[model samples]
Target chain A: MDPLLYDILVALGLGLLGAVLFSAIGLISGTDETTTIAPVTLLVVLLGAPPAGVFTFWMCAAISKHMTHAVPTALLGIPGDTMALPLLQQASALRNLGAPHIALRKMLAGSVISAFIAVPLAVLFAVILAPFGTYITASAPWLFIAASVLIAYFSAGRWASVIALVPFTLLIVALQSFTGAHEVKLGVSYFLGIAIGPLVAELISAASPLERKRMNRSEPRETTLAPDVKGWGGYFPNPFRVLDRSQVRATATAAAITSGTFVFSPVAMTVIAGEIVGARIKHAYHRLTSVLAVRNGVTESTYIAEALIPLIAFGLPLSPVAAGPAAPLFNAPPRFTVNSETGVVNNLHTLMSVSEFLIWGLVSVVIATLIAYPFAMNHARSAAAFVAKRISHEAIIATFVGLILVIGLWEGGVIALLVILTVGLVGGLLYRVLGMNTGVQFMGYYAAVLSVPAILKLLG
Target chain B: MNNPTPAPASGPDGQLAEIWGDVVSRPQLGKAILIGAVVSLAVYAVALATIAPLASTPAIGKALAMLAGIIGCILGGAICARLFQPKRRVVEQIAPGAIWQTEVLDQIAIEGGAIGSVEDLPPAVAQEMREVGLYSVFQDYEQDRARNREAG
Candidate 1:
C-alpha cells in the first residue's frame, strides 16, 4: 500500500478512536478537560504514534470532547469544562425555564455548525498569519504581556484579572526558579495545578471548619431534570433547522469572528461574542438560548483557531489555548520538544507543513463530526440522564490524581509532585476567591516565562 | 439512536437581524473584579522584596519564585474574598409556571411560522413572555420583511 494511503487509514481510524473515547468521557459531567485530554495526548506522543496519527487523535479528541461536553452544561446545570463556563449562565437560565432539552439541542446544533466552519477558517487565518511568524516570535515577550493584559481585561473579573496576573506570574516565576534549582524542570505540573485548582481548593476547604461551614448547605441542592421535548422529526435533524433564523446567523457570525482571534482566550471570546449578541436581543429567553448557542460556537472556533494558527504560522505556543490544552502538539518531550533552554524547535511546527496541517485538521474535524455530533444529537437525553445519575466524581478525580502523580514521578520525582500540589492549592484558592479563571492563569504562566524576564532585563 | 441526516444550510439571512438587537445585556461581575485587582497588586508589590533575591539565583530562582507566588495569591485571595459579596441565586425564583411558558416559546420559535402576537398565546404564556421582553411579532414584522427583501 502507498505510504499516503496507509497514513490516511491510520489517521481516519485514530480519529474515530479518539472521538469515541473522549465523547463518552465528556458525557461524564464535571470532568475537567485538561485532566482528560492532557494525559491521553501525552500517551499518544510517548507511544511514538506517527505525526498524522498524533494530529488526528488530538484534533479529534478536542473537537469531540468539546462537542459532547456541552451535554452536561445544557442538561445537568453543570459546566462541562473551562470553555463551557460561559454557557452555564444560559444553561442554568434555560433549565430554569424548563427546557434543558431545547438547550441541549441548540448547543449540539451550534457545535455542528461552528465546528465545521472553524476548521477551514482556522487554516485560512493561520496561512495569512504565517508570513508574520518571525516578527511575532521576536516580539513574543512583549506580546505575551499585551496578551496577558488583553485577556485579563476581558475575563469575568475584568480589570481585576489584569491586576491578578502580577501575583500569578510572580508565583509561577518563583516556582520555576526554585524547581529549576533542583534540576527538576517541570511543565505539566503547573498546567495540572491550574486545571485542577477548584478541586484542590474544595479539598483544602473541607479540612477547615469555617471554610467547610461556608460550603455547607442544610438542604440538598435539587436539580429538576426537565422532560425531553417531543418535537422535531427524524434522527439527527438538520442542525441549521433546529435553530431559528437569528440563532443560525449569530452562530455563523460569532464563529467567523472568533476563528480569526487566535491569540485571545477562548472563554473571553465566548463571553464577548455572547455579550455582543446578548446586547442585541431583547427577549431574555431568546437571549439565553441564542447566547448559549453562540458562545458554544465560539468555544469550538476559538480552539480550532488557536491550535491551527500558532502551529502553522509560528510553530510556537502563542495563544493560551495553544499553550495549555494544545501544548502536546507543540511539545511532548522525546518525539516533539520545543527546547526552553536552547530555543530549539522540533514539534509540529518543524514536523509538518501548511498543506499537511490543513489536510489533517479537516480530516480530524470531519471524522469527529461524523461520530461525536450525531451521537450527541440522538442520545443526548439518555447520556445526560446516565451521567447525572451515575458518574462518580471520586472515580474521575482519583484517575486524574493518579495520572498527575504518574506524570510527576516520570518527569521529576517527588519534587514535581510538590510543585503541582503547591501550585494547585494556592492557584485554586486564588482562582476560587479572586474570580481569576484557569484561562487567565494559563496566560499568566506564559507571561512568567515569556514576559517577566524581559521586564526584569528592561528594569535592570 | 437513529442514524444522522444531512444538515442543509439555511438562507435568507438578513431578516434575522432582529435576533441580534439588544433587548438584554449580560450583567457584569463588577466589584469582585475590582477588589481582586486591588488586593492582588498590593500583595505582589509587598511580597516582591522578599522574593526578589530568588530571582537572582541561578536554577533555583524558579522554585523560590513559586514560594513567593503562593504567599501573594493567598493574601490576595483572602482580601478579595472579604470584600467580594456573593450574589443570591435567582434560579430559585423561576416559578414552575415560567418553565411551561418557556417551553411554548421554544416551540413557537422553532416552528418559525406567523403568530398574531404574544397576546395570541395563553394568558400565562403572554405574561411570562412579557417578563422576558418578548412581545408581538407584528411589532417588527415590516422591518423583517424589508430586511429579508434586501437580503434576498
Candidate 2:
C-alpha cells in the first residue's frame, strides 16, 4: 500500500470525528459562521499537519461551509457567496412557502451529492490527464477570447450590438492600461460597472407608469408534513440516466467531432456539454430526471476536468470557486504556477499525487451528509416554524442586502459595488434597448478583444 | 384600496421571471468587451516596447512579451466575452419554482394572470419562460451519464 493512502485514511478518520462535532454545533446555533473557521482551520493544518490530514480537515470545513451557507439563503434571505447565489434564488421560493428547511435540505443534498461525485473525479481526472494538460493550458487565452466574441455577436440584436462591443472593450483596455499601478483604477472600474449595470432596468423601473399597478400574486403551497425520503432520494439527479442505446449510438457516430475539441473553460463548456448529453438522452424514457442528472454530472465533470487540467499541465491552479475553500485547507498557495523555462513539467507527477489526499473531501461529504441529512429532515418542521416566527420578512431582506453589501465590498471593494451595479444596469439596458441577451453582451466584450485589435490593424 | 400582500410564493416567481430583462443591457456589455480587448493589446505593446531596456538577454524580453500578448489575447477573447455577454436572467436561475418564486411570472401574472399556474409547470418550463433560459440542463445530464458509463 502506498504510504500516502495509509496516512490519508488515518487523517480522514480523525477529520470525520471533527465534522460530527461541527455539524452538531451548527444544528444548534443555526449558523455556520465563517469569520473564524477559515483562519482557525488553516492554523491547525499549517502547524505540522500532514497533507492528507489537511485534506480531511478541509473537507469537514467545506461541507459545513456549504451546509451553513444554507441558513442565510434559506432563512435570512442572504446568499453566502456568488456561487451560492443561484442556489439561494431557488431556495428562496421554498422559503416563501415557509418551508425553508425543505429548500435547505434539497440544496444541501444536491451539493453533497455533487461534491462526492466531483471531488474525487477531479483528482483522478487531473492525475490521468497530466500529459496533455500543458497544451490545453497554453491554448486557454484564445478560447476565452473566441467564446467572448461569439457570445457577444450572437446576442439578440446582431450587427449594431456587436459593433458596440468594440468601443466598450477598448475603453476597458485603455482604462486598465492607463491606471496600470493605481489602486483607484479598480475603484473606477467598479464604479463604471455598477452604475451602468442596472441602468436600463432602473430606467424602466422609473419610466414604466405601470409600476403603480398592483396585483395579488398566488400564494405558495405551505407544507409542514415530513418529506418522503424516497421522493427526496429521487430528487438526486442521476448524472448518467440519459445514455440510451440509440442516443449513445448516434453520439458514437460523431465521435470524431466530440473527441476533436478539448475543453479549457470549465464554466463555459459546462452548459454546452450538458446540453449535448441531454440531447442524446432525449430518446430515453424519464427524460426530465435523466436530463437533469446527466447535466449535473457534466457540470461536475466540467468543474473537475477544467480545474485539474490547469493544475496538471501548467501547474496553474484556476478553480477559484472550489479552490477558494480548498486552498486554505491544504495550506496550499492560492495560485497554481508552471514556468516554461524551468522545464518543471516533470514535477507535475508529484503534485498530481496530492489528489490522493482529496479522497478525504469525498469522505467528509458522506459523513457530513449522514450527520446533516437527519437534522434537516427530522427537525425541519420546528426549524421552519422557528425561522418564520423569529425572523421578520423585513429583517430577512435587510440582512440579505446587508450581506450582499459586505460581500460585494469585500470582493470588489466599494468600487466593485459600483462596477457590479454598472454591469447590471448595462446588462439590463442591452436587454431592453437592443433586445440582446446578457450572454451575448458578455460575449461581445470578449470578442472585442480580438475584433478591436483586428480592426485596428486593418485600419492602421 | 388595500394593497394585496405580495405573497412569498409570488415574490420569488416574479424575481425569477424578471431575471432576463434585468440582466443584460447593451451599453454595459459593450464597455466590458472594449475594456477586455484593449487591455490584452496594451499588455503586448508594453511587453514589446520595453524589450530593449530589459537587462541581460534581450531575447528573453521578446519571448516574455510574446507570451503575455498571447495570453492577453486569449483571455481578452474568451473570459471577457463570457463576462460581457447578454443572457436571459432565468438562465441564471438555480432551480425550479419549487425552489424559488419566479419573479418574472409574478410580474406577468400581475399584469393580469396572462401566464397562470407558473408553479404547476416543470421548473425547466418556468425557466424557459424567462428569456435567459439555457434549455440545456437535461441535455448536459445525458452527456454526463454517457461519459460516466463509458468511464465505468
Candidate 3:
C-alpha cells in the first residue's frame, strides 16, 4: 500500500470516528465545544496519531457537532450549545408557528451548505495570509497580548473582561511558577481547568450557603418537545432543495463573507450576520426562517475560518476558536508545541503541507455532512427525545468529573490536580462575576505562557 | 394551552438544585462525582501497575493507561445513568395554530419586527407559509390591523 494511501485511510477512519462521536454528543444539550473537543483531540495527539488524522478528526468533530446541535435547539427548545444560542429565538418562533421540523431542516441545510463553502474559502484566505507567517511568528509574544486584549474587549464582559485579563494572566503565571517549583510543568491541566471553569463555578455555588436559594429548584425544568413533521422523502435531503433560492443565497453569501472575519468571536459574528440578513426580509415568517438559516450557517463558517486561518497562516492559536477548541492542533506539547522563546512551531501546520490541509479539510467536512446531516434530518426527534429523557445531568457531570480527575492526574500527579482545582475555581468565579468567558480565559493562558516572558525580559 | 404546569416533586433522598444548566438531587450528584473519581482513578492505577511495566516505553504505557481511564470515565457515567433518572418534566407540545401562535406574531411586532403583508413574500416563501397553514393567520392579522387603523 502506498504511504499516502495509508495516511488518507487513517485520516478517513479518524474523521468518521470524530463525526459519529460528536454527532451524538451534540444532541445532548449544553455540551460545550471547547470542553469536549480539546481534551479528546489532545488524547488523539498523545496517543500518537498522525498529524493528518488529528487535523481531520478535529475538523469532522466541530463540523458534525454544529449540524446536529440544531436538533436540540429547534426541537427541544433548548440551546444545543453556546453557538446554538443565537438560533434559539428563530427556532422558538418557528416552533410556535408549528413548523419546528422546518426550523431543524433549515438550520441543518444552512450548516451543510456553509461548511462546504467555508472549507475551500477558508483555505484560500489562509493561503493569502500565509506570506505573513514568519513575521507573525516572530512577534508572537506581543501579538498574543494584543489578541488577548482585543478578544477580551469583545467578550460579554467588555471592559470588565479587558480589566480581568491582568489578574487572570497573573493567576496563570503564579500557578506555573508554583508547579515549576515542584518540578511538575503542567499544560493540559490548565486548559482543562479553564475549559471546565463554568461547571466548577456552578458546582461550588451550588454548595455555598449564600447561593443556595438561587441554586435550589423545587421543581424540575419543564420542556415542551415540539412534534416533528418530516417533509422530505429520503434519508438524505438536498440542502439546496430544503432552502429556497433566496435562503440558499443568504446562507451561501453569509458563509462566504464570514469565512474572512476570523478575528472576531463566532457568536458575535452569528448574531451580527443574522441581524443584517434579517433586516432585509419584510415578511415576518421569511424573516424568522431566513435568520435561522443564516445564523446557523454563520456558526459553521466562522468556526472553520477562525480555526483554519490561524493554523495554516501562522501555525499559531491566534483566533478565539483556535485558542479555545482547536488549541491542540497548534500546541498539544511534546507531540505538538509552539516554542515560547523563538516562536517555532511543531504542529499540523508544519507537519502537513498546505495542499494536504485543504484536501483533508474538505474530506472531513464531506464525512461530517454525510453522517451528521442525514442523521439529524431523519432521526432528530427520536435522538432529541432519547437524550432529553435518558441521559441524566448527573451522569454528564460525573463524566466530566472523571475527565478532570483523569486528565489532571495523567499530566502531572497530585500537584497538577491541585492546579486544575485552583485554576478552575478562580477562573470559574471570574467568568460568572465578570462575564469573561472561556475564550478570553484561553487567551489569558497564552498571555501567561508567551507574553509574560517577553515582558519580564524587557523589564530586566 | 394544554401544557401542564410542572408540579414540584419531593426528592427521594435530599434537596434538588439546578447546577450547570440542569436540575439534580444534591445527594445523587455527590454520589455521581464520587463514582466518576473512584472508577476512573482506580482504572488508571490498575493500568499503571499492570500494563505500564509490560510496554516498551513508559510514555506509551502511560498513554494507553490514560485511554483506559477515559473508558472508565464513560463506564462510570453509564453506571450513574442507569442508577439515576434525569430530573426533567417533558411535555409533548400541543398542535400548532393556537392563540399563542398568533401572539408570537404580536410579540415579533412588539420587538419592532415588520409583519409585512403576505403580498410582499416571494412565491416560494408564500407557498411554504400556506403549506405550514400560517398564510391565513398572517392575512387575517393584517386585515384586523387595517380595520382598526380605518376605524381610528
Candidate 4:
C-alpha cells in the first residue's frame, strides 16, 4: 500500500466520521458550538490521532455542524447554536409565512455553496496574511480589547453590550483567579457557563413562585411542519436547484467576502454580509428569502474562515472563533502549544503546511457536503418534524448540563463547579435582562485572559 | 379611514425599512443608554479601587479590576432594564399571500433556463410563475447546473 494514499484514505474516513456525527448533533437545538465542539476536538487530539486525522475530523465537524444547525433554527424557531441566532429572525419570518420547508432548503443549499467557496478563499487569505503573523501576534492583547469593545458596541444589545463587557470581563478574571489559586486553571467550563447560562437562568426562574407563574403558558408551544416540496425533476434532487439566481449570487459573494476577513466576530460578519445583500435587493419576498440565504451562508463561511485563516496564517489562535471554539487545534497544551509571550508555537503551524491545510480543508468540506447537504435537502420536513416533536428541550439541556458538570469536576473538582454556577448565574441573568449575547460574552472571556493584564501593566 | 396606519417608509432600493424602524425613535432608549454608561463608568472606578489590592501580578490585578467592573455593570444593567420597561410588539411585516416559495423555485428553474413553462398549469398560475421570472426554454441538467454554479 502506498503510504501517501493510505494517509489520504484515513483522513477522508476520519472527516466522514466527524461529518456524520455532528450533522446529527446539529439537529438538537440549543447545543452551543464552543462548549460541544472544543471538548470533542480536544478529545480527538488527546486520543493521539494522526495530524491529518485530527485536522480533517475537526474541520469536518465544524463545517457539518454549521450546515445542519439551520434545522432547528429554521424549523422550530429555536437556535441550534450561537451562530444560528441571526438566522432565527428570517427563519421565523419564513415560518410565519408558511414556508419553513423552503427556508430549510435555502439555508442548507446556501451552506453547501458557501462551504465550497470558503475553503479555497480562506486558504488564499491565510497565505496573504502569513507574512504579517509576527506583527499581528505581538499586538494581540491590545487588539483583543479593542476588538472586544467594537464587537460589543455592534452587538444587538449595542451600548448595553459595551457596558456589560466591563462586568463580564471582570467576572471572568475573578473566576480564573479563584480557580487558579487552587492550581486548576480553567477554560472550557467558563465557555459552558456562558453557553448554558440562559438555560440555568430559566431553570432558576422556574423555581420562583412569581416567576413560575409568569413562565406558565396557557398552552404548549405550537410548531407547524410545512409540506415538503419535491424537486422540479429529479430522483436525488440536487439541493442547489431550489435556490434562485440572485440568491445564489448573493450567497456566493457574501461567502467569498466573509471567507477572507478572519479578524471580526462570526455574528458581526453574518450581520454585515446579510445587510450588504439585503440593502441591494429590491423585491420584498426576494429580499426576505435572499437575506436568509446570505446570512446562513455567512455562518458557514465565517466559521471556516475564522478557523483556517488563523490556523494557517499565524499558527496561533488570533481570531475569536479560533481563540474560543477552535482553541484545541492550536493549543491543547503539552500536545499542542503556542505561547503568546515566548513566541513558542508547536501547533498546526509547525505540523502542517499551507498546501496541506488547503487540501484537508477541501476534503473536510466535501465530506460535510456529502453527509449534510443531501440529507437536509431530502428530509428537511421529516428531520424538522422529528426534532420538534421527539427531542425534549429538557433532555438536551440536561445532557449539556451533565457534560459541563463532568468538565468542571475534571478541571478542579468542587471549586470548578462553583465557578460554573457563579458564571452561569450572573452571565445568564445579564444576558436574559440586557440582551448581551454569547458572542460578546466570549469576547469578554478573551479580554479577561489577554487584555485585562495588559491594561493593568500599562497602568502600573 | 378610521385607523389609517401608513405603510412603512421605503428605502431608495424600494424595499421597506426594517420592521423596528419605529421603535428606534422611542425617547426611552436614549435615557436607558445614558443611565447604562454612567453606571458602567462608576462601576469601573469602584472596581479599580477595590480589586487593585487582591492581585499577585499586573495581569492578575488588571483582571481583578475587570471583575470589579463587571460586578458594577451587571448591577447597573439590572437597574436600567427595570427603568426601561421592556414590552413586546408583534409587527407583521410579510403577509402569507406575499410569500410564494414554489413560484420562486419555478422562477429559479426558468432563469437557470431549465424550462419554458410551469407545465399543465392554468394561465393565471403560469402568469404568476412568469411574473416571478419563470419564462425560458428548457435546457439540459448539466447546462442548468453549470449556469447556477457560476452564478452561485
Candidate 5:
C-alpha cells in the first residue's frame, strides 16, 4: 500500500477507536468526550514522541481523536476541549429554545470551516513565520504584558475592571517572580505549570459547588439538514449570512493566528486571544453576534494553537489533548517525550512530521463535518427527545464538579483541598462584593503581577 | 445539608462583591499612594541586598529579584486594603414581584400560533423572556393557572 494510503487507513481506524472510547466513557460518566480528547492526545505525544517510529503513530491517533471529540459537545453539553465551551453554551441555549439540531448543524459547519481554514493556514503561516520565531519569542515579554492589560481592561469592563488592574498587575509580577525562580531551577515552563495550575484548579473547585439534587432535563436528537440550510453554501464562507459569516471569520482568524504564536506562551495567548476576540466581537457586533463569534473564536483558537505549537516549534507530539488516543499506537509506553531534536530524513523529522499532521488533520475535519451534518439532521428530533427524557443537567454539572475536585487532588495532593477552600472563599467574596467577573478578577491577578514591575522599569 | 443562607437584607452575590471591593479599595487615595511609594523603596533595598550575594548569574538574579519586588508590592496592596476594612459582607435591597406585565403574553401567543390564553402572564414578562430565550419559564405560570381553574 502507498504510505499515504497506509497512513489514512491507520488514522481513520484510530479515529474510530478514539470515537468509541470517548463515547463509551462519556455516555457512562455523563461527561462530554470532546472535553477530554485534545489534552489526552497531546499527553500521548509528550510521553511517546522521542522514539523513531512512534511520531507517525501519535499524529494519526491525535487526528482521529479530534475528528470524534465534537460528537459529545454537539450532541450533549460536554465540550471536547476548552475551545468547545462557547459552542456548548450556544448549543445548550439553543437546545433550551427548541433548535438544538440547528445549533449543532451550525457548530459542525463552523468547525469544518475552521478545520479546513485553520490547518492549512497554520501550516503556511508557520512555514512563513518560522524564520522570525526566535526573535519574536525573545520580545514576547512586552507583548505578553500588553496583551494581559488589554484582556484585563476589556474583560473586566473598561471602568469596573480597571479597579482590578492594580492588584492584578502586581499579582502577575509576583507569579512571574515565582515562575522565574522555578525557571532558573527547573529550566522551563513545565514546573511553573505545576504551580500556576493549582490556582486554576482551586478557582474552578471553589466556584463549582456540587449540587445535591438532580434537575429535570431534555436531550436533543441528532438533526437532519433542513432544506433551506443545505449544501456547500451552508458550510462555507457565505458572507450573506451575517451572523454565521462573522463567526467563521472571527474563529478562523483567531484560531489561525493563535496556532502560529503557540510557542511564545500558551496560557497568556489563550486568555488574551479569548478576551480580545470576544471584546472585539462584542464591540463590532450585537450581543448575539458577539456571543457567537467570541465563543467560537476562543474555543477553536485554543484547540488549533495547542495542536500547532508542539508540531511546528519543537517537532513534538501535539499537546495532551491530541496525545491520549495516539498512545496505544506507539506501543503504549509508560512515559516518552515526543520531541525530535535530530533524526534521519524521510524517517519523520519534526518539520515534515508536523506538516503531515496538519494536512491529515485538515482532511479529517472535512470528512467528519460532511458525515456529522447530514446524519445529525435525521437524528435531531429523536436525540433531542431522548436527551430530554434521559439526562439531567444539574446532575451533569455536579458530576463535572466532582471530576474537577478529583483532578485537582490528583494534581496537587492535599494542597488541592486548601486551594479549593481558599478559592471558594476568595471567589465567593469576589462574586459577592466585586461587582465584576470572577474570571476577570482571576485574570487580573495574574496580569497585575506582570504589570507592576514593567511599570517600575519604565519609570526608572 | 445546612447551607448557610444570606441575611434577609442582602443577597449572596451582592454581599460577596462588596467585600471584594472593600478589600481592593485604595484607602485615602493619597495615603495609599504614599504607602505604595514607600513599599517601592523597600523593594529596592531588598533587591540591592539580595542580588549582590545570592546571584550566580548577576543579570538573571537581578531580573528575578525585580520580579519579586513587583510581587511584593501587589501583595502589600491587597493586604493593606484587607487590613483597612476587615472582610465583611454588605447587603442591599431586593425588589419584588414579576418584573413583567400581561400584555406581551397575548402578542407572543398570537405570533407563535398558540391559543391566546394570555391570562396567566403579564405581556412585559412574556416579551422580555422571549427575547432572552427564557420563554419556557412561563410553563410554571400555565401550571399554576391550571391548578387555580381546577380549584375554582
Candidate 6:
C-alpha cells in the first residue's frame, strides 16, 4: 500500500473515533476540555499512533465536541462544557420564549460555518508566522515566563492569579526535585493532577465537616428540559438556511478575526465576540439568536486557531488552549517531547510538514462535521434525555477516579500517585480560592518546567 | 404489624451532597469511587502480570495494559450507573404561553437589549420569525407598547 494512502486512512480512522467518542462525552456537562482531551490525546501519542493520526484525532475531537455541546446548553439550560457557558443566557432566554430549537439550530449552524472558515484562516496565519519559529523556540524559556504572567493576568483572578503563579511554580519545582531524588520522573501525572484539580478540590471540600453546609443538598436539583421543535426536513440541515444572511456574515467575520487572536483565553474571546455582534443587532430576538450563533462560532474558531497556530508556527504550546487541551500534540514525552533545557521539540510539529497540517486539519474538520453535526441535529433531544436520565453523576465521578488512579500508576508508581494527589489538592485549592483556572495552572506548569531552569542557570 | 406513624427517620445513609457540579448521595459516591479505583487498579495489576512478559516491548505492553485499565474504569462506571440513579428532577417543559413570552422579552429589554419593531426587520429574518410563529407575537408586543405610550 502507498504510504500516503495509509497515512490518510489512519488519520481518517482516528479522526472518526475521536469524533464519535467526544460527541458522547460532550453531552455530559462539566467535562472540561483539558481534563478530557489532553489525557486521551496523550494516550494516542504514547500508543504510537502516526503523527497525522494524532493531529487529526485531536482536531476532530475538539470540533465534534463543540458542535454537540450545544445540545445540553440549548435544551436543558445546563452548559455542555466550559465553552458553552457564555451561550447559556441566550439559550435560556430562547428556551423561555419557547424556541430552544431555534437557539440550538443557530448554535449548530454557527459552529459549522465558523469551523470551516477558521481552518483555512488559522493555517494561513500560522504560515505567515512560521518564519519566526526558530527565534520563538530559542527564546522559549523567557517566552514561557512572559506568557504565564500574561495568561494569569487575563484569568478570572487577574492580579491574584498572577501572584499565585509563583507559589504554583515553586510547588511543581519542589515536587520535581522530591521525585527526582526517588529516581522517578513524572510528567503525565502532573498534567493529570492539574487537569482534574477542580474535581479533587470538590471531593475534599465535600468530605470536610466545615464545608458540609455548603456542599449538602437536601433534595435533587431540578432541571426543566425544554421541548425541541424540528424546523428542518431532513437529517442534514443546511447551515446557510438555518442562519439568516446577517448572522452568517457576522459569524464568518467573527471567526476570521478571532483566528488571529489565538493567544487570549477562548472564553473571553467568545464573550467579547458575542457582545460586539449582539450590540449591533437592534431586535431583542435577533440579538439573542445572533449572539448565540456568534458566541458558539467564536468558541470553535478560537480553539482551532489557538491549537493550530502554535503547533504550526512555533512548535510550542504557547497559547492557553495549546498549553491546556492541546498540550500533548506539543509535548507528550518519549513519543513527543519538548526538552526543558535545550528548548528542543520532537512532536507533530517536527514530524509533519505545513502542507500535511493543512490537509489533515481540513480533513478532520470535515469528518467531525459529517459525524457529529447531523447526529446532533437529528438526535439531540433523545441524546440529551438519555444522558440525563441514565448516566449518573456518581458514574462519571467513578470513571474520573479510575482515570486518575490508572494514569498515575502507569506514569511512575506509588510516588507518581502521591505527586498527583499533592499537586491536585494544592492546585485545586488555589484555583478555587484565587480563580486561577486550569489554563493558568497549565501555564504555571510550563513555567516550572521551562522558565525555572533558565532562571536558575542565570543565577548560577 | 405496622404502626400508624413511623418513627422519625435517622441519618442512615441519607446524606446527599453536591460534588463536582451535580448532586449525589454521599454513601453511594464513596462506594462508586472505591469501585472505580479498585476495578481499574485490579485490571492494571492483572494485565501487568499476564501481558507484560508476552509482549515484544515492555513499553507497548504497558500501554496496552493502561488501555485495558481505562476500559475497566468505564466498566466500573457502567456498573455504578446500573446501581445508582442520577439525583436530578428533570421536568419536561411545556410550550410557553404569550404572557411568558412577553415577560421574557421584558427581561431581555431590562438587560439593555433593543426590542425593535417587527416592521423594521429584514425580509429573511421576518420570514424566519413567521416560520417559527413569532412574527405576530413580536408585532402584538410592539402594538401594546405603542398603546401604552399613547395612553400615558
lDDT of candidate 4 over B1-152, digit per residue (tens):
57575443332212111111011112333344455445555655565567666767654454455444444444554565445432222222233442354444345445432323234443443343344332222123234656899999
TM-score of each: 0.72, 0.42, 0.97, 0.71, 0.43, 0.97
Predicted structure 2: lDDT: 0.41
Candidate 1: where are CA atoms >4 Å away? A1-6, A92-98, A157-160, A163-167, A230-234, A278-289, A341-344, A451-460, B1-152
lDDT of 1 by residue, A1-460 (tens): 9988887788788888899988988786666666567657766665556788888898999889888988878766767777888888678756665667667778878877898898888889988888888787777778768877876776667888889899889999999989989887777677777776766676566456676445433222244444565456676578787777778989998999899998777877888998898777655556667788898888889988888888888877777777777877876765676544234568888778788888888888888888888888778778876655443332233334445554554456689888888888887777677777676787788788667877788899
Residue by residue across A205-301, what tens digits does model 4's lDDT show? 6556666444533223444445555544553456455567667888999999999877777988898887778777544345556778888889999
Report the C-alpha lDDT of model 5 over A1-460, residue by residue, as the tens digit: 8976665676565454443444233322222222234233433333323232234333333332333334445444455443354455444444433333345444444444555566676667556656755554344335435544444454424555556556544544444455455452111122212222332332333334341111111211222211112223333333223234455566666666765654332334545655565454321112223344444433444445445543454332223322222222221212332211111112133325555656655655544444443444344334333333343322222222333333333333344444444444443444334533333443343333323445566699
- Model 4 chain B is weakest, by summed lDDT over 10 consecutive residues, at B16-25
TM-score (C-alpha, index-matched) for candidate 6: 0.97
Candidate 4: regions farther than 4 A off: A1-10, A77-79, A88-99, A232-236, A338-340, A453-460, B1-152
Which lDDT tens digits does candidate 3 get at residues A1-460? Answer: 9988888789999999999999999999999999899899999999998889999899999999999999999998999999999999999888888889999999999999999999999999999999999999999999999999999999999999999999999999999999999898888899889999889889988889999888888877788898888777878999998899999999999999999999999999999999999999999989998999999999999999999999999999999999999998988877888888889999988998889889999999999999999999999999999988999999999999999998888899999889888889988998889999999999999999899999999999
lDDT per residue for candidate 6 within B26-134, as digits (tens), equals: 9899999999899988998898889877889999999989988999899899989998899888999977899999998889889888899888889989899998888
- Candidate 3 positional error at A328, Å: 0.7
Pairs in steric clash, model 3:
none
Residue A84 lDDT, candidate 4, scale 0-100: 89
Please state the CAPRI-style docking class of candidate 6.
medium
Number of clashes recorded per candidate:
29, 104, 0, 3, 66, 0
Which numbered prediction scores highest in DockQ against the true structure?
3
- Write the residue-wise lDDT of candidate 1 on B1-152 in tens digits: 77475232122211111000001001111232333344444444444446545565532343343334434434444443343222212132233563454455445456442334433344543443444334433234434545889999
What is model 3's native contact fraction?
0.85
Candidate 1's TM-score on the B chain: 0.31
Candidate closer to the true structure by TM-score (higher is better), 2 or 3: 3
Candidate 5 per-residue C-alpha lDDT over B1-152 given as tens digits, one digit per residue, 9 for 90 to 100: 77585343322211221111111121232244445445544564476477635867664454445444444444445444433332222211122123232233333344332322334444543443455344544454556657989999
List, for all models, the DockQ compared with the true complex: 0.03, 0.04, 0.65, 0.03, 0.02, 0.61
List the candidate 6 regions with Cα displacement exceeding 4 Å: B1-13
